[model samples]
Target chain A: MIKGSLTLDPKIIRQDFPIFQQAVAKPLVYLDSAATSQRPSKVIDAEMEYYQKYNSNVHRGVYRISVEATEAYERAREKVARFINARSPKEIIFVRSTTEAINLISQTWGRTNIQTGDNVLLTEMEHHSNIVPWMMLCKEKGASLRYLEVDDDGFLSLDQLDSSLDNRSKLLAFTHASNVLGTINPAKEMIRRAHDKGALVVLDSAQTTPHMTTDVRDLDCDFMAFSGHKMLGPTGIGILYAREEILDRMEPFLYGGDMIKEVHKDSARWNDLPWKFEAGTPNIAGAIGLGAAIDYINGLGIDQIRAHERAITSRALDMVQSIPGITVYGPKDPDKRAGLISFNIKGVHAHDTASILDTHNVCIRAGHHCAQPLMEKLGVPATTRASFYVYNNNEDIDMLIHGIEAVKGVFKL
Target chain B: MSEDLYKEIILDYYKNPRNYGTLENPDMKAMDTNPLCGDELEMQIKLGESDKIADIRFNGKGCAISMASASILTEMVQGKKIEDARQFNKEELLGAMGTPNLGPVRIKCALLPLKVLKLAIYSHLGKVLEGDDRNL
Candidate 1:
């Protein structure tokens, strides 16, 4: 691992991303990093190097280059495990995406452990990825699905979780941070409480992994999942961190060639922890890119990135609140959030607001953010979301504010 | 990316919508949602004995394009037949908006009202217009 304390002066970070160097449609104000992050040259070049110099199928080849390729692939897995502070590289299962990773855990663990009378505890602020799988699992198993509600500021009510964490609770899954509200849940505490009730906990870190330093070992959750695309890596690659013992107890998600020790006409023996979860040819380039992304994030440091986002979010909260008729959602304190901000303007539709912002070359997400239950709690069908990343700066926030002002002017509301 | 598409008239309708409230004893009612943006529109139609639309009312939340499109569409289809009203789709709305290159997002916004209108037609008349989904 590279040794360095984090320091983020936005000017220096912007140099790493080539997308910021060009002229933009409006002014290239990108605030949708929570959905997906912009890749740095280092991550891009890493993928290119793999295809250009060391292109081979890993684990099955005996040639010199194949060995090198296999080493790199395993090293990537190790890096992923290190990034999340998992106990072992074997615990890190590479899947197509966070959605797929959650589906894997749900199909394997949910199908096996959770019974008809069991309960799976989820949160209202969970993205559709985390909620839908458990819902499907509960429906199929004749189990009950429970949700932890949030306060008006989108704060997860841990006190409310006290009554819900009962003997029937077999699985507890939730997001580390909300994609829309940016509310960072008390993941460690939640994990502890769920464990107290003898339930497995899965943390969806798709929003948290990019902006915060994560140590799954310290969190001590049963499983955690995050997408590569949301952390400056290529799409179609994600990591599923399952505790080794838990994985050993769980069944394989898919059945195919690479995932089997030996196959008979009627039955097959599953290979191992990580491979059993990954059953296909896999996104080879994407894994390499994700490894490079871990390198990039580690180089910059997640603490520095988090600090930078805090500064920017503070500025954004001030700016958006300063505007009359503007209403901000989520917690008021920056420390309570990750790197996203959602808001609404009186008498303005979120799509209209987003369209006007797009005219100014500002990119923000405007919709339910796949958290329909949270949207209902917020009392709006949709809201404009401005998510930040390492590449974002004060100027980007200013541009977002300017874009909102322009929208207000055009609408004159 | 087209600010011109969100004309003053559109915002006027959004701020002080024409048919803001519900209708009493409505003849036809339809609700449509732009799943992408989460905009929901519930439109109610009042038809005359002559098989022509006498009045139209809508209640929902959406962007300027959808709100404006709904405002303009209700006006356009007030005295027209269900078939003729179905003909007024995104192309006519874009022509009304006077934009050359409208993106899919804006197109979605513009087509929200039309979708509700179509749903109303389908529910009332039992026939979905051809190629309505592809209009955007």
Candidate 2:
């Protein structure tokens, strides 16, 4: 037996999430955290407290509640900055989702910097959010988009990266951890290489920041985008962290409202670092909820969470590989991968497998997983993805294995 | 037993699909893809005399529901007239699947072949009305 490294007691952790208390078709084996994590009561209570106590807009209102609301919102920003280890809170710009964060970068930074014949390097394992924005930006700017190929084992080829990172490459946009494959790319080393090649790196940490400890300063990435919902927080809130200099240089993405210093009839000067990017009213409650989520994760300790997930993932991978005709994707070493596994049983469709698992109260994400390009590259239509989190334990993996066996039984394989 | 969405018939159709290939010099051919799942179906119908579907075939890749539905669709519309084939609705397709209570996502997979068939018929009608005989 592999030595267990889980420090957090999942039984106790599940108590913090009240969703388990409610009735369902069967016992919920939530293995879909990579899609969206279930929110804990702390995060839910934080948002509820915001609405119950001070539910006013931020920045403009000088009333007492407004001031308190603004303070809470900015405090959330500070919490996020500290969570990601950014130099200052001004580097953290709140957006709707990871998709919006990437879009903001593409529109502001990409529009300004990318030129005709410039290349934006993306990896094959990227979610549609990371790939689509760059594709649109490159098309609009007449710049070319290149991909860093993923090998058969679901790891990106460094040789392909080296060859692709020519002087014409302006930005290296890649996922820190793949949502489907669970392969954690070496962001620090890749960032260093891209910086040497005179290219800015945009780290799509939507799948990474929630699971592992992330330090933007240490990674030295020019920009990083991640969603709140994927990290046990509410949806409609995401963070985009850019260096101060880069934020100062790029134009504002959305126009109008609080993003401006003064709105003249003709042209107007923009607001300071973060506010200029955050136009209109933001997801106030979502941000505050994310702050509570950060605290929850911090209290549990991200290192311990990573270890716990690694243990679950390692066990799942081992047991899954033992099954006949099962093909598991991503790195074999548990340390190299995030807390998830993507696999397929031979002669069984991923949807069928997922349906059967769902009947067994095991929730695994199936379909192309918004990474059609990667699916095509993998030579499969789709694969079933089961992602783990702090609340998931060895029992969940055992349930999933049993669910897979049930699927085989149902299919008469 | 309660969760038998993958019935033996569905699996049989998926494993041994009927009329599962391309057609040469077809009268109508159209394709539609489920962008969410990357499921695609390309349908071809060779119209015989009196606008009857003399031969119908489908070629694509998708989940069991989609592929089986496509296979079943080819068998359903093979001898039907163009007008009758075009009139085939989602309920009839779902009925053929033997599972009317498909979940939201699977519904899309089950109806993809019907959508493609309707589009093929529409294209054929459009071409005939436009006085264009060349294959589309």
The Cα local distance difference test for each model comes to 0.85, 0.89
State which candidate has the highest DockQ. 1
Docking class of 2: acceptable
Q: Model 1 clash pairs?
A: none
- For model 2, name the residue pairs that clash: none
DockQ of 1: 0.81
On the 0 to 100 scale, the lDDT of residue B93 in model 1 is 65
Assess each model's interface with DockQ, reporting 2 decimals per model: 0.81, 0.49
Off by over 4 Å in 1: A1-7, A23-27, B132-136
Which regions of candidate 2 deviate over 4 angstroms?
A: A1-5, B127-136
